[model samples]
Target: MNSTSFDLDPSYHILVTGGAGFIGSNLCEFLLNNGNSVTCLDNFATGKRENIAPLSSNSRFSLIEGDIRDLDTCQQACKDVDYVLHQAALGSVPRSINDPITSNDVNVSGFLNMLVAARDAKVKRFVYAASSSTYGDSKNMPKIEDIIGKPLSPYAITKYVNELYADIFNNTYGLETVGLRYFNVFGRKQDPNGAYAAVIPKFVLQLMEHTSPVINGDGSFSRDFTYIDNVIQMNIKAIVTDNKEAVNTVYNVAFGERTDLNQLVALLKEFLSEFDAKIADVNAKYGPTRQGDVPHSLASIDKAKKLLGYDPQFDIQKGLKQAVRWYWENLK
Candidate 1:
């Protein structure tokens, strides 16, 4: 069945916090397209209105310009909402390390507020964006959900704390919640011009401009770069799936594949150079490793597979093709 025809009974209303960011906007679009009423709550701090501009005319989609740090805002956003997908956060390790207080306020304090609101609203299930950075300092390939090391950055600590609070809510308040530990999610609509943009979009824009992209280290660091569609699918499965074993648990949302920075540059260049051959020779500059940066990170998505029936359709290369095409047509 198509997404619209899927059996997501309308008795449930959907609330998506941060619903104007790249991932959040996509989620809102998906939910609206599937015939569900979606209420988007975003402060427009990191999120942009243009991300949801196309949906402004949709009657089923409503926007609330609000901050999650405020308990009243969170409470109001959760009202009458059946499912909550909390994606708001102050991402970027460098940003977090520089201003741990703000990161903690948004990712931790705001997260708690959302949890309280969700509990008070009695939402069916609360799902939020957990980070792969939670696997900080693990030194393990294919990081699993159960095994996490000490957080290497403030952002990691905040995300790990989200899982902790979510678990506590489930145990103490009887709230059904699921945490998705996303690993390097990237694709269309991801901001490319920010000081803290993710590597894929940043590199694509630089290459398109015939400029060299910077590799923080020797280009050996790797990540399990996942596509946005897969992340969307995971969110859908997280709420709609009836697997009791999956509830009150965390799952690694990734492609189960790792690609190094050098390989990533090569792939993006290959895909983008088609738009302008000059992009092919876009050299990469090497710099000292970034602070709070992990050497290598991968994910074991087997638990998600067995529990939520998550089957990622797009790998890194495939996702890059679509993302590159989007940037070329839209940005250029």
Candidate 2:
């Protein structure tokens, strides 16, 4: 669990903006497990304390309940932190469609606040979560980081704006920053009960409950689903990496492969059936295509590999197996 022996210092203080959220909580555990000091700031909006329950006793970890939309809260979280991992945002295309203003306020304005606060705090580096949705209308086979299309949803616009503002901050204020454009991330502690829950978790939960999961559009719609552990590895490399070329650049965080919904469901059913045979017979219901949903997405990881020595340890099959196992043991 210690990275100190691997030449990483043990006393680095890292601040995670949405530390109680699924991805944020995972990063917190990774940082703390590697012998780094961590401060988690969350408003409990979408994030939950249960996500961080396992780390409650870690002396190297601290928690602050606050909103990033408030500049003061952002400032407080940045104080004395060596690195900033900004993960707080109201995410979900449908949620954004229902309430665009709030999504922009949290995802865009709050992101700007974090950037300014990190700049003022003089943190070593600021790494924020961007999204694959930034590649909105592009029809390219493998989505490269440099090439992007117009946003299809308000949520996508907000995330794309984060990268723009991060670039501006770096150029205008001299604050070093990196934006990680994460593809569909799935893993343990991902909440599956919400109306705006991501597909992987929601489908897993539905299968567990003996309910049919809805597949919007034809089963041909595809995505490059990344694993939580790979994401944690990217964040760590972003903060601690000595590669100057990697800093201040946006990298696509994905497995570099795509899987269609039908394939995804088949894989999920295959894995879950090991726990309960009845699930293998459970078929998904097809519905009208979702609003603001893209038909396909696949990231080209060549840029990340060339710049950051990026390497993904889990592909969709490997990740799905681990994720389904977690849901079976924890959820049911």
Instruction: Please tell me which predicted candidate would have the highest lDDT against the true structure.
Output: 1
Task: List model 1 lDDT by residue over 1-332, tens digit each.
Answer: 14642356655679999999989999998888787899999999999899999999998889999999999999999999989999999999999999999999999999999999999999999999999999889876779888889999999999999999999999999999999999999988999988899998898888888889999999999999999999998998998889899899999999999999999999988888787888888899999999999999899999999998888999998989988898888898
> Over 4 Å off in model 2, which ranges?
1-7
TM per candidate comes to 0.98, 0.97
Cα lDDT tens digits, model 2, 33-148, are 88889999999999989999889799999999999899999999999999999999998999999999999999998998999899999999999999999999998879988889
Full-model lDDT for every candidate: 0.92, 0.91
lDDT for model 1, please.
Answer: 0.92
CA RMSD of each candidate after superposition: 1.3, 1.4
Angstrom error at residue 22, model 2: 0.7
Q: In model 1, which regions exceed 4 Å deviation? A: 1-7
Native RMSD of candidate 2 (Å): 1.4
